[model samples]
Target: MNNVALITGASRGIGHHLARHFYDLGYTLILIARHAPALEAFAATRDPARITTLAVDLSNTATAEPLLRQVLSDHARIDVLVNAAGIFRPGSTQTPVDDFSTLLATNVTAIHLLCQLCTPWLLKSAQGRIFNLASISGVQPFGSIASYAASKHALVGYSRSIARELGAQGIKVTTLCPDVVNTDMAEGSGLAADEMLSTEDICRAVDFVMSLSPAAIVEQLTIGRQPRPRQPR
Candidate 1:
């Protein structure tokens, strides 16, 4: 049987590209996102038998368990799980409490819940891989995106802790920290698109991680662009 991969945020950005990459590698796919129509549309472009789409807001704790249970019921096993659904907002110390709460809910809490719910299915697979989409901000402080950075940092810590706990079970958990990608989220951060990494670049990293042998594991993979030459003064 083909390996099965369930990717959150599969409707767009890095997750969308990863979906295509995995499909090209012949894996059965379960695409999840908040937008049902968009997920359905993307899945329609692929072989219907190999693709499944679920419209879910991962941040909704109450719905996440039921949704994951349904996925396990429909598919025999899930070899890979990608937690790529995230949100970012420009903020400073003075940012509203609600803004910070929203970021934590979507970026950190949702990832935690999904990992908890999916661990069992992942353990059942012979070669299970869990990829959490973190950001460089998770490792470094970014004043402009304070809340986002904090949430990502939390995700990074959680990922590493779980990796250690699950390693014995043959489940490889990796936290992917990319500096800046040319996605809607990056564009919203007011960064120059030309200087950011492409979605394909991120997907390539995913491909590499997924290709590793069962005995090998990458706990953290950080990808960044080269520094541009300084302009003559």
Candidate 2:
């Protein structure tokens, strides 16, 4: 049987690119997103037998676990679990409490819960891997996105701790921290999409991590965009 990879946020952006990349690598895909139509559309483009689509709002933590259990029940093992679903709200300390809560639920809580739920299937794989898509904001404070930063920071810490705890079980967990990717989230933050990293860049990073030998592991990786050339005077 082909290895199975479950990717959240597979509707677009980095998650979408990663899904395509993994498909090319011959892995069966479980694509999850909040939009059912989009997920189904993407899956339709692929061999239906090799792809599964699940429309889920990970932020709705109340229903996430049961939903995930139902979807995962059919698969005998999950070789890769990519927690790439997240939301970003740009704001300072003045950001509303509700916004902060929403960000936390999607960005941090969902990843944590998914990891817990998928651990058993992961453990069954010979080379199980977990990739949590965090942000450079996890490492440095950005005043405009305080709440988003806080959630990513929490993710980074949690990923590292789990990596250590699960290493003995042969499951590797890696936190991917990238700075200003060319995505809707980064564009919403007022960054120039042309000047930022591409989804391919992030996907390449994931490929590298996943390609490592079973004995080797990258606990955390931070990726940044290349500097743009200065305009001539």
Candidate 3:
């Protein structure tokens, strides 16, 4: 049976690269994101039998389970789940409470909810591992992207607690805290202008997380920033 690694936010960025990485490693994929056309296009470039996709907005209650259950029905087990779907709304999140709520809904809330729903299937995989795309922003205060940062911060805390809870189930949860990745997420931000992490680097962390022995559980792995180059000698 082909192990299915379900990757959310698969249309772009680290999710996109990770999807390719797993596909090359002979794992079937269930790629999910909000852009159906983009996903269809992306999957076209991969092995047809091993790749499937769902363009779903996790914020919609009706969409999440229907899509996940569909994938579950076809694949006997979910070997891995990478909760990489996130939003970066960088502006004055001034007075709109709904905006903040939506930010949390997409980033923190959806990741938590997906874990809850996928528990049984993941446990059935037995060797399964879960990875959440956390950020260094979680550990430090971000200047302008307050809501986005706070949501990611909450995700790290939530992931820690869940990792403890799921340890007995043979499930490993890893929170990837990479400082300033050079993805669409980093573009336009001050962090982008400075040296940043690469999607390939993050994808490697995901691969490493999945490669661990059943007994080995990595609670948290932080990929630190590169040292700045000297300006003047």
Candidate 4:
């Protein structure tokens, strides 16, 4: 049987790319995203039998949780889980309370709930792997994106703690903390495409993580771009 991979944020960005990668590798996919058109379009190009697309807004866990449960009911096991659905709110300490709440809801709470819900099914797989896409902000505080940073920090902390707990049960949990990637999110943050890491760089990190043996687990993989050289005056 083909291993099952449940990937959130499947409409675009890193998640979308990874979904394509896994699909090409013969893994059954359960793709979740907020936009149905993109998901449907992607699904249309592939074998419909192997793909399941769910358009869900992760910021609303109450609505998304049950929908996820219903979808997982038909799948026998989940071999790979990529929690890549996230939202960014650019602001400092003076950021609106609502922005902070939304960031935490989508970036932290929703992933926590997903890890909880998928643990059982993951345990059933021979090579269960959970990949949580965090950000450089998770480790280093960035200016003007305080709420986003805080939420990622929370996610990083939670994922690390669970890595210890889940490792004992033979599940490998990897937290990917990549610097700005060339995605819509990064573009919206005023980062030029040249200044950010490519989606392929992030995907390479995942490739490395997935290649490791069962005995070896990658707790965290951080990928950053090299600084451009200073031009002489």
Candidate 5:
């Protein structure tokens, strides 16, 4: 059987692009998104036999595991798990409690839940991989996006801890921290389209990580644009 890849946030942006990339690489894909119709709509473009789509609200942490279990019924093993589903709310520490809760639930909690759920299946595969999409904010806090940054920082820490925990089992965990990819999420973040990295850049980084031998492990990979030349004002 082809290697199985389970990806969350598969309906659009980075997730959507990764889904397509993996499909091209001949991996069987289990795509999950919040909306069934949108998820299925993308799945329709791929070979039906190799694709499985599920609608899951990552923010609903309590229900995620059960929903994931239900969908994995067909696949005996998951070679890769990509935690790409995330929420970004712009605000400082003063951001409302509800927004903070929502960001934490979706960004950090859901990733933790899915990692636990997929560990067994991943262990069964010879080349197991887990890729977590974090951000530059994960490593350094920004005043404007305090809550979002906090959650991402948590994710980065969690991912590194698990990388050490699962390393002996031969499962590689990598957290990708990119600076503003040109996705819908970054549209209004006060950055021009040309300034952000493309989805292709993200996929290429993933490909590089996957290409390494089991002996090599990358705990975190940070991708960012080079500093633009300062226009003399």
Candidate 6:
């Protein structure tokens, strides 16, 4: 692909690994996140020439259009988009109504707005690809992380619907749903990450999505734990 890729939530975790993998394959990178220091560290290794970093909170839904416009205008073109940035706030029976709005805005609204603004630019490039980082919970009624799972489930449906609409335009949309991973988010969950998937594993899936022929698309791929889980003693 001769065009550049824009990656959100690229400061670390799955986002960081994806940036590395894509850069190795010669894809120009545009990394976006809110943390300046982490962004800088990523740039140091990825190089400022091939990979450009943007410190922005994509959760600001109202500014998505203008912000994307500026970035695209400066970069000249965007061939691929990795919607890796996400907010996962687990809610329980006591989940507050006020906080639910914030979770929905960050998890669902941001991705929706970015995809809308990214379409025109993506169509311009021959290798236009949209990768949405969804979760296996999207396919099941995952009750533990209530709001997080709900948002992802909705996102999966939204992404699939958009895929049908955009397929003819030569833009491929892929939703990646991986079971628990060894990321910072999982660290605080009190769940044992033994043999859990790594960020690199998911990034590999992203790379595979890019490598597929336009005639075929991996619309939904469910990745999960290794060896499966054993029953309690």
Instruction: Report the lDDT tens digits of candidate 4 across residue range 23-138.
Output: 99899999999999999999999999999999989878889989999999989999999999998888888989988999999999999988999999999999899999999999
Candidate 6 stretches greater than 4 Å from native: 227-233
The TM-score measured for candidate 4 stands at 0.97
TM-score on alpha carbons, each prediction: 0.95, 0.96, 0.92, 0.97, 0.97, 0.92
Most lDDT-accurate candidate:
4
Ten contiguous residues with the weakest lDDT in model 3: 88-97
List ranges where model 4 is wrong by over 4 Å. 188-190
Instruction: Give candidate 3's error at residue 114 in angstroms.
Output: 1.2
- Residue 30 shift from truth in candidate 1, angstroms: 0.8
lDDT against the true structure, each candidate: 0.88, 0.91, 0.84, 0.92, 0.91, 0.81
Stretches of model 5 off by over 4 angstroms after superposition:
none
What digit string (tens of lDDT, one per residue) describes model 6 on residues 1-233? 34588888888888878887778878888888879799898788655778777787777866566766787777766888988887777775567877777777777888898798889889888778899988888887767677777888888999898888888888888888888778886777666666678887897787777777667888888897777568999
Model 1 over residues 55-161: C-alpha lDDT tens digits? 98888879876987787788888899999999888788987999899899999998888788788889889888899999999998888888889999999999999
Per residue, candidate 5 scores C-alpha lDDT tens digits across 1-233 of 89999999998989989999999999999999997888888877778999999897987867777878888767899999999998889998689999999999999999998999899999999999999999999998798899999999999999999999988888999999999999999878777877889999999999999888768899999997877789999
Residues 102-156, candidate 3, lDDT per residue (tens digit)?
A: 8889888899878987888899985878899888887788778787787888999
Residue pairs in collision within model 1 = none
When summed lDDT is taken over every stretch of 10 residues in candidate 2, the lowest stretch is: 184-193
Measured with C-alpha atoms, the lDDT of residue 126 in candidate 6 is 77
Q: lDDT tens string, model 2, 173-195?
A: 99999999888777655667678
Residue 125 of candidate 2: its Cα lDDT? 97
Candidate 2, residue 183: the lDDT equals: 81
> Could you tell me which residue pairs clash in candidate 4?
none
Query: For model 1, what is the C-alpha lDDT against the true structure?
Result: 0.88
TM-score of 1: 0.95
Q: Candidate 6: give the clashing pairs.
A: none
lDDT of 2: 0.91
